[model samples]
Target: MEELIYFHDHALVILTLITIIVFYGLISIITNTFTNRFLLESHHIETIWTVIPAIILIFLALPSLRLLYIMDELNDPHLTIKAIGHQWYWSYEYTDYQDLEFDSYMVPTQDLNPGQPRLLEVDNRLVAPTHSPVRVLTTSADVLHSWAIPALGLKMDAVPGRLNQLSFLTPRSGVFYGQCSEICGANHSFMPIVLESVPLNVFEDWASSLME
Candidate 1:
């Protein structure tokens, strides 16, 4: 999400510039048409419209292609977590560690802690280290599901018997939340994804404790 947010901000800047240019162009065209009429040849007008749009498209396409490339650049991950979507819950297994796994169930609103988000809090949160590449392999236990974290700009469908991989890094230590994006069945709303990003040493300690 750290890099994704930067990309989004860049896109917004481009869009804002485009909007301003179009607005000014429209105002100028309207003014010229009502005041001084200089009729250009049809071919000349066609060429102007076509070439300008082509240039703009190229400009837009360049950034879009760069962003896509950035999105696809999967690095050698430091940690890998396997996520299995069930009927009404998400179970996560830390593949890098031995026998470290947990089922994450959404914390009911009535049971939420002081700072916990209602419906977004989970009993078990997937923990990872900050500023490191993390890979998530997703699959389904029963039906179709989608593991999505909006902040990270990550969404991968969990298909039964098939695995979908997602990779990203947290810029800093914090808590990020998400939910099952796919409409699996009746209790779909109860499936929430909670991620706790901690410092590298803190993560190792937690993982070590789990092994004990």
Candidate 2:
């Protein structure tokens, strides 16, 4: 996510520079002394058009390549979680722990508690620790579905018989939400993905309580 933010900020700066340069060129052309032939053709015009664009292209490509590299770089994960999408729900497995697995069903709007988000609440939320490297594996049991979280900048396809993986880290404790991006079935709209991040001690306590 930091890489994405950097790319976005760099793009804004480049856009501002381009805008200023264009306005300056337009004003200079208007204020300059020009004959009919000077307006038609100039030794500087052709060279400027070609050379300036090449330089701009190189500048744009540098950041684009950097972003791609950042996206593909995979680091050693401290925890691994596997998520399998069902017809209208999701199942999760904590592979790093003692066979901890559960199904997460979306909470019905009628059953939602006060201050709870409608259609976004789930019966079970995947919980992890903050400031830790976490890897997520995705697959589908039936139809196609997409596991995505916009805030974390993660979007992976859940294809049948194939596994896709993505790694992310949350520096702070918060609840993140997402939904099935693919058209699965009639109840697709009801299915949502919820994740909770807490301190390492809190997460350990929560995991231990499940066994008790």
Candidate 3:
């Protein structure tokens, strides 16, 4: 996620620089009284314009391609979880643990706690330990759905009968919220995703409690 944010900032800086330069050039042309017809046909100016843009594109493409490759590369995961999308809810399974599975349904507006967010609270949250590479496998039991969390820079489609994978490592413990990005059906807006990151020992205790 940090890498994703850094790349976004890098691209934004480049885009801002390009926009300023182009705007300045446009202002200069509009304000200038001198008309040089020969300058319009100058191969030197044409080459400069073409080469500069190409160079800028290379700068953008190199980092973009690098990130792409990194995202596609799956490392050895410390833990694995499977998230199955239903019509209006999500079910999760801790692959490393026997019988550690549960269904997460959104808490209705009337059932929400005083400080809880409306349409975002869930009955159960997908939990994992902090600072560990956790692999998430996603698929749908019904129609198409998407599991996306912007803070984690994670998004993957959940297609029927086809599992998709992504992984993340959170440096700190916190609760992250997300929603189903794909429009599946009538209650599409109800399904929400909540992930809780805790310490390794705390996570173990929680898991053990569930198993018992």
Candidate 4:
């Protein structure tokens, strides 16, 4: 995730520089009355323009490819969870445990607690330990749905009869929210994903409670 963010910022800087240079050239052309009667395209300027863009693209592509490789590399996850997307909710199963599973539904506005954010809160949150590699296997029950968490840099399509996987780790304990990115049905907007990160001991206790 850190690499992804850094690449994004680097691309943005390159884009900003290009935009500024283009605008500056435009303004110079508009404001200045410098026009030669025998003006012709210079090979020097053509080569520079072409080479500079190629160099910029190389800079962008290298990082992008590296990020893709990193994302694709499957690590030895400490825990694995399978997320099954439903019509308007999500069901999760901790594959490591025998019977630790539950359905996660969006909390209606009327049922929200004092500090909970509306439309983003869920009845049950997917919990995991911080500083651990957790893999999520995503698939749909009826239709297409996207299991996504922007904060964790995860977005995988939940296709029927197919399982997609993504891995992530939270550096600190906190709550992260996400929503279905695909347009499935009428209640697609209501289905939300909430992930609660806790310490390893807390996560173990929570899992034990569910098992008991």
For model 4, the superposed segments whose C-alpha errors exceed 4 Å read 31-40
Cα lDDT of model 4 by residue, 155-182, tens digit: 9999999999898889999999999999
Q: Return the TM-score for candidate 4, rounded to 2 decimals.
A: 0.92
What are the RMSDs of all candidates, in order? Answer: 2.2, 2.3, 1.4, 1.9
The models' CA-based lDDT, in order, is 0.87, 0.89, 0.94, 0.93
- Displacement of residue 152 (Cα, Å) in model 2 is 1.3
What is residue 143's positional error in candidate 4, in angstroms?
Answer: 0.4
Clashing pairs in 2: none
Query: Tens digits of per-residue lDDT for model 1 on 32-107?
Result: 7535234454577778888987886787678778878877667788999999999999999988888999899998
TM for every model, in the order presented, reads 0.89, 0.89, 0.95, 0.92
How do the residues 47-158 of candidate 3 rate in per-residue lDDT, one tens digit apiece? 9999999999999999999998878777889999999999999999999999999999999999998989999889999999999999999999999999989899999999
After aligning candidate 2 to the native by TM-score, how far in Å is the CA of 37 from where it should be?
4.0
Q: Count clashing residue pairs per candidate.
A: 0, 0, 0, 0
Model 1 residue 97 CA deviation in Å: 1.6
Predicted structure with the largest TM-score when compared to the true one: 3
Residue pairs with backbone atoms closer than 3 Å in model 3 (clashes): none
